[model samples]
Structure formats: structure tokens, C-alpha cells
Target: MKLQGVHHVAYRCRDAKETVEFYQKHLDMDFQLAIAENEVPSTGEPDPYMHIFLDAGNGNVLAFFELPSQPQMGRDTNTPEWVQHIAFKLGSMEELLAAKERLVDAGIEVLGPTNHTIFKSIYFFDPNGHRIELAANTDEPGMLQELKRVGPEMLEEWSRTKKAPKTAAWIHGEGEFPGYQG
Candidate 1:
């Protein structure tokens, strides 16, 4: 079956109200809907939760679950915090930088407008300690095509060696692409 776009992505939150307020104030997300249930419909377990949905623009929805019955929440220690995050796309570099400034002004510590050749992004954490990223795409005219062309080879080599492949170093202008002069 072919899948359409995501209906929503759900995560645990400490407080439904606080989470909603945080997204609404900081990210300008609209509080779309909320569902409170005494028992999980799928499992029929005796648990109460507040499931909240927020509009994340362009028909995307971000959701959170506040489980009063569950123990205090924490993140996976085994995984690097930076490795697991929800990234959002900003319209442009100016917009991304403006967001970083606004967040900083609000006393939220943020990191980066880190460059990745094709994009630049900033990172921050939500009230739930979930890392969030706002990125603006900055791909040059033919950069994406070149990257896509070598993607398979890069992946195969990386799989075999478990090391970064040099096939796409030109993405960062480390060297020229073979047979093509800039």
C-alpha cells in the first residue's frame, strides 16, 4: 500500500497545557485538538492520558501524550541527545536566524545555524527535553543533483567500511568532483 504524508507524530510530555503553551508561544503552532481517555482503546488498559495535537504547518500535525498514571519521563541514555530530534523546515536563512534570535530573547538556549552544505539549522530543546531543529535549505543549483548521483555509491562504501566516504566531499568543497570543473 502506498502511504500518504504523516497524519501526526506523537511523543510523551510532562504537562499537556505547558507543552501546548510552549509550542504556541515559541513556535507559533496552533493548538488543534486534544483527546483525553480513561483507557487506551487499543489495549483496554486502565490508564488516563491527555493527547494533544498541534498544527505544525502545511497540514502536518505534532502531538503529545500526557500520561498521569505513568512514571516520570526521561530520555534514552544510550543514545546521544543530538542524534534523536524533530527537525522543522524554516522558509529561509533569514527566517531561521530570526527564530534563533527570538528564542534566545525568550531565554531559551539555542545552538547552531550549523552549515551542512545544503542547509543551515539551529538546535534547541523543548520543555520535555526533546531536541528540536529548525533548518533552512540552501542548496546551490546543481549541488543536490550531484549528491543524489553519488548517494548510492557513498552509502555502499559507508556500509562496508563504517567510515565517512570521500565520494561526496565536494559537497563541502573539500575537492572538485571528478571530470567536472567548477
Candidate 2:
């Protein structure tokens, strides 16, 4: 079967109302709809929940579920906090910097306009303690193509050695790879 695109991405939230308001105010996401059910539709279990959907621009949707019956929400203790985050893309670096300024003005502690070679991003936490990243593309022509070319080789090397391969070290401004013209 061929997949078209993502329908939506769902996560757990502490309070549905607070989540809705936060997304609306900070991120300018429109509250598209909400679903409330007293029982699981797939299963027969009686677990009431409030599911909220927000329009995340360009036909993308971000959703959250508030399950009051469950215990307090907690993150995975094993994974590093920076590893798991929801990233949204902006059109330009100016927009990214503006967003950081707006978030800082609102008294939110935001980290970075950090450069990732291909893009720049800023990080902040929502009221629910979910890390959010707003990034803007800054890739040069052929950069992605070069990375794609070396991806399989890098993966194979990583699988064997369990360490980062130097095939794409140029991404971090290291010495260029052989046969790289970009």
C-alpha cells in the first residue's frame, strides 16, 4: 500500500483547555476540533478522554489527548530530553528569529537559534513540558543531494562500527569528502 502523508500526530496533554489555549496563543494554531468519548472506540474499555486537534498549517494537524483517568503525565527517563521534540518549520531565518523574540518577550525561556548547518532552530517547552522546536531552512543548493548520496554508506558504517561515519563530515564544516563538488 502506498501512503500519502501523515494524517495527524497525537500526544498526551495534561489539560485539554490549557493545551488548546497555549497552541492558539503562542503558536497561532487554530483549534480545528475536539473529540470526547467515554469508551475506547477500538476496544471496549471505558476510558474517557478529550482529544483536541490543532491546525499546524499547510494541511498538517497536531493533536493531543487528555486522559483524566490515567496517572500524571511523565516523560521517558531513559531518553535525553533534547532527542524527542516536535519541530515546526518556518520559511526563513528572519521568521525564526522573530519567533524567538516573541517567545522571549512572553517570558518563556527559549534556547537557541542554534545552527544545524542545513537549518537554524530555537527550542522551548510548553506548559505540558513537551519540548518544541521551531526551525528555518538555510540549506545551500545540492547540500541535501550530497547528504542523500552518502546516507546508505554512512548507515552501513555506523551499523558495523557503532560510531559516526566521516562520509558526511562536511555537513559540520569538517574536511570535504572525496568527489564532493558542492
**For residues 1-182, could you state the per-residue lDDT of candidate 2 as single tens digits?**
99988999999999999999999999999999999999989997999999999999999999999999999999999999999899999999999999999999999999998988889999999999899999999987777888888898999999999998988887777865344344
Residue 181 error for model 2, in Å?
A: 5.4
User: What C-alpha lDDT do the candidate models reach, one value each?
Assistant: 0.93, 0.92
Candidate 1 C-alpha error for residue 33, in Å: 0.1
What TM-score does structure 2 among the candidates reach?
A: 0.96
Cα misplacement distance, residue 53 of candidate 1 (Å): 0.6
The candidate 2 region of ten consecutive residues with least summed lDDT is 173-182
Candidate 1's residue-wise lDDT over 54-149, tens digit each?
A: 999999999999999999999999999999899999999999999999999999999998988789999999999999999999987777777777
Clashes of each: 0, 0
lDDT of 1: 0.93
Q: How does model 1 score by TM-score? A: 0.94
In model 1, residue pairs whose N, Cα or C atoms come closer than 3 Å (at least 3 residues apart or on different chains), thus clashing, are: none
**Clash count, predicted structure 2:** 0
